[model samples]
Target: MKILVTGSEGFIGKNLMAELRNRKYDCIYEYCRETDSTLLDDYCKEADFVFHLAGVNRPKDQSEFMDGNYGFTSELLEMLKKHENNCPVMISSSIQAELDNPYGISKKAGEDLLLNYSNETGAKTLIYRFPNVFGKWCKPNYNSAVATFCHNIAHGLPLTVNDPSVVMNLVYIDDVAEELINALNGKENRVEEFCEVPDVHTITLGEIVHLIHSFRNSREERSIPNLNDSFTKKLYSTYLSYLPEDQFSYDLKMNEDYRGSFTEFIKTPDRGQVSINISKPGITKGNHWHHTKNEKFLVVSGKGVIRFRKINTDKVIEYYVSGDKMEVVDIPTGYTHNIENLGDTDMVTVMWANELFDPEKPDTYYLEV
Candidate 1:
């Protein structure tokens, strides 16, 4: 079915789009705001379903939150009521809507607008109140509490808990995305007023921190570093060594199959080298681009595909080679690339580069194809 997704640039919106695409659903993204009404109306007119997930969840002040979350949603709902042709709407609300924060108050108002509009227009309205969502592409400082804790623990920072006793439900973003896809596919008559999207597990802040530390510690033990002597110290060293020399950064294990440890690598030098080994076929390393480093790769063994693309351009080049005919592939600095093992044998490659990996800098970009 043709579906319209609002706030398609935000974290949840991005995850939802990925999930929908995986399910083979026809979906279109639209950023809804005061200035984008015409574009939004055009999308709504053609959609069989509308996932209204736009608006800000946090603001510097209460008025900003009100304007961003409540006001924007109210206006969107009014426009939907006038322009939409009875397309079902799935509104992504927040658990904060039940709290007293300005974010919550604004979300409550947005929900009311959706329900009232649905009652008047005969449009199906489904509201999802999400708890703290974690996993994959979550930005620590801006996303949620789990991200903050994970970011700290990944980098070997002591999980600083303002209150360790406070319990929060942490749901995986994949789970939430799957639920959204399910809702989108289900019969419209089965839609409910509200759903508390349950998490696979609920954890305390302290537990979350410990989990990350444990994972990172386990990784260091298994890696070439073999830091079984003192996992904490080794992790700290590993983190410091890999961190961008000029800036502070951390790495979160977003994918389920992240084989290497979740140790946060910080760069402390303008130029350095970090390496990993892929011992099996089907292992892929990095679909990311760096703006700073001119990376070079040597095929230690086996066969693989080295795919690279220039930034902001559609020009892409793929190089396929095997162990018997090994060659060093030079990826031009400031390009996106990934190495995937295509041969039946293990592909051992060494990534030696001079660019420091920085998450905040516009260095790494992700591509699906």
Candidate 2:
């Protein structure tokens, strides 16, 4: 299907266009701010579907709001009429359109025009009065407070929140794009005369800041966020999008000894902890067993021997592990176990314990295996 997307380079437009293309829809005519204005007429004439996403929310002059939002919308509808195109049209509108402000008025005017056109030609139309949409590719330092805050915080820049107490209704960009695709297929989430993206979330400005800040501190605290929470999962995904390309990785604290070093990779409240361990040749680490805590150790580099022994039995079970032949040895509770590096080089092992190590109640006792 031939699809025409206005404001193709804008945040929402970019996301939607990318999603459409990823779905293998190649007949897309994109008109961004740089495109020649007259080309919109040809695009409107040829498109089987129109995504009227072009509009001004942060223009330098207030009058530009009406010109870009309402005026351009009227022009596109007129072009569709002139070309005798009865294609389905979807307009991106803001919930602020319910207000009496100039921007809202312009957006409402655009919505009215689309509704009237749908009536006039009996063409399918979708009007989404979306709340604050946040996710990857959203412009920073503009209208979206979420975008600005994420960019600033991710870059270590100072931010100014005029009203931290203010609450916001947020929708994720992926959800918005998905809903738009659904609308294109006539499977819209209609509410009254307009449509809505399902599962919009509400959070206070201060609360959002706290959640994002916790994501930043996770590195130092060696803890993972409660990703089971939907809002936090989406917000964390958005936060990572703002990180600089060069700063994708952070250094972890490493504990070193005569044997080698161990670094905690991730720690989760319900899933326990994962650590990377390195042992020098002829070095033995972890000659200990836990009463209740359990672990799985995988040798990823060099050769190693993992030996296990029951608390009372004299029988010793040994597993010779090599990096070329990766294997995981599970350490059961009450079974004393130790890993000894047997190769001439250092051995690297990835360890996953069912519980995080606790100093006060370690539940660990050293014993020869």
Best by TM-score: 2
Clashes of each: 9, 0
TM-score of each: 0.58, 0.97
> Candidate 1, residues 163-231: lDDT per residue as tens digits?
877887656666678777777777332325686554445667765566556555644432223234332
For candidate 1, the TM-score is: 0.58
Residue 217 displacement (Å), model 1: 0.6
Worst 10 residues of 1 by lDDT: 259-268
Cand. 1 Cα-lDDT: 0.67
Best by lDDT: 2
Clashing pairs in model 1, backbone N/Cα/C closer than 3 A:
242-266, 243-265, 243-266, 243-267, 244-266, 244-267, 245-267, 245-268, 245-269
What are the per-residue Cα lDDT tens digits for candidate 2 across 209-246? 98888888888888898889899999999999999899
